[model samples]
Target: MSSRDPSLSPTLRLRARGALANETGRFETERREAFDDGWDLPEEERLLRTEVRIERPRSALTYNRSPDLPFDRSVNPYRGCEHGCIYCFARPSHAYLNLSPGLDFETRLIARPGIAAVLERELRARSYRAAPIALGTNTDPYQPIEATHRLMREILEVLAAFRHPVAITTKGTLIERDLDLLAPMAAEGLLRVGLSVTTLDPNLSRRLEPRAPSPARRLQTIRRLAEAGVPVRAMIAPVIPGLTDSELDRLLAATAGAGAVAASWIVLRLPREVAPLLRAWAEEHYPDRAAKMLARIREIHGGRDYDPAFGKRMRGEGIWADLIARRFRLAAARHGLDRAQPPLRSDLFRPPPRPGDQLSLL
Candidate 1:
């Protein structure tokens, strides 16, 4: 009798997840494989389940020296995303935690409890300098689990109390729930939002980002945020050369119609495990165009699946990259999104008074 591991073969029924396999991380010394013992296990067992662990953060701000990044510091309240986008470049980061960058990256998550308190202490430090602290830089801060954890709201409360500047990027519609905090911060020039709209077609979005919000839903989110007076920038990230690249102009038009004030785009990036993961996903989902799609992706990346070079990693290199850049510039200009999002104000920052501090009456 022949046997197979059910989870090894994902099906359309898994509407809540992505990733074709739970491949072992590169750092793992011993590999693991599932075995069918012929006991006829129930099919419901095949469904993947998400698990969350709490971490007490010793530090709130993670500073990066990456030359290409717009911000130097970011705060990630959660690690391991629930929205399992098959092509996520952040997947490989899970390997650092001794976890697989595949299915495990989405199934296993970490929530930082009491992180807002830690952040408040850090901001209150006399040596601490004020800058726009970015959220959702490494992992989405507003993932579904956040609705229960309420960490994002607590952090925002701290920032609001201190009058600190912040910039957040996300695809989660749950951000709308915090308009009470966001609207006033934006009015003071202390906030901006990046709503990632990878594709306008819901079908492609379903396969590409199974657990993330739909393309239409994201457009509505942009409109909602804009109506609240918050600056919303449409982010057209990872334009898949053969798949969603053609939608660039249409995407800008749609976002503009939804009231976005600015726009940006980045070509597909397949670093580390992402290269193979996306290849397998493409073959499974788009067998007819997988080869051509991958070929063009490599062409843009200087004949490699990915080039980690700081200057070239995000936007890529060569003729195709130039062409995409030109198209984005033209589309952005036509849509009145040629400008960058307004810079957040740091001058408004004032640390909240701590307990036991001397009070003065004037």
Candidate 2:
């Protein structure tokens, strides 16, 4: 059987593609159906191919007032993430486009090629105030498709030209390709990167985040970025309760060994449609632990699958949450990864020259 064939595994037999099912979006007024003939198809024929659609949005920057987040402004060059992570909190966002939060969220992606120009215009606005704009905040800017479209690179060039500060969070090793630009930005204290490392076990990583870089590759990425003078932080994001949480110390130590100067973590969050997807994934891949894992999750969230309240969202609320936090603190401190890094400098920002503007006569 082909590697992508879900029928090969008992847990994956339910999913023809990456997700368990192609659920209809909440806003979709219409529904569709598919029928499989008796004839068996080849693995290649059954494989789901990704489709990229171009989008020209009027604005590129997304502003949010959530207290749980560190930054107020973010840029998402892509609409949907190709990394088919089962626990992705951003899955619900696909509903806005009348697409399924399941398989469609990974296969049907939207690329904004004109985002760089829009960002430039916004940055050049007279009322604009300079601040560190976050990248990979909504969807990864360095997903697999980014290598072909290069929209993220174009956005980086715009930020580089204007000397705008940027903070990037991603799981793709593709960021290593832009060291030439990022290294210089790092020298000026305008760039910081966070590499999210979910688990150390290759099998678990593959089952949870199918398309993301391997744990080893991510560690190498952290090393390369740190060597390039870029501030690197290891993000142990969406720490699953009974599944991957036990490896917290090992993950932190590994990251620190890879030259990550700081660390952070967020407890697993299952908001909206993500809850059902994760529960299904857990039941399929880890049937033995599914009940216990889900019970622990609810325990942390106070009898609910998730608590959307800002303060309790990122780091749940309960004894289990406190235990995880305490463990992370000890591990981080042991590795000397508790040092606070300086914030990205926005003072170097300079508006890009507009069309028809006079050249400076220096």
Query: Using TM-score as the measure, which candidate wins?
Result: 1
lDDT of each: 0.89, 0.89
Encode model 1's per-residue lDDT on 117-144: one tens digit a residue: 9999899888999999999998889889
lDDT value for candidate 1?
0.89
lDDT of 2 at 31: 69
Give me the displacement of residue 334 in model 2, in angstroms: 0.2
Distance (Å) between predicted and true CA of 107, model 2?
0.4
Q: RMSD for all candidates, in order, please.
A: 2.7, 3.6
Ten consecutive residues with minimal summed lDDT in candidate 2?
Answer: 1-10
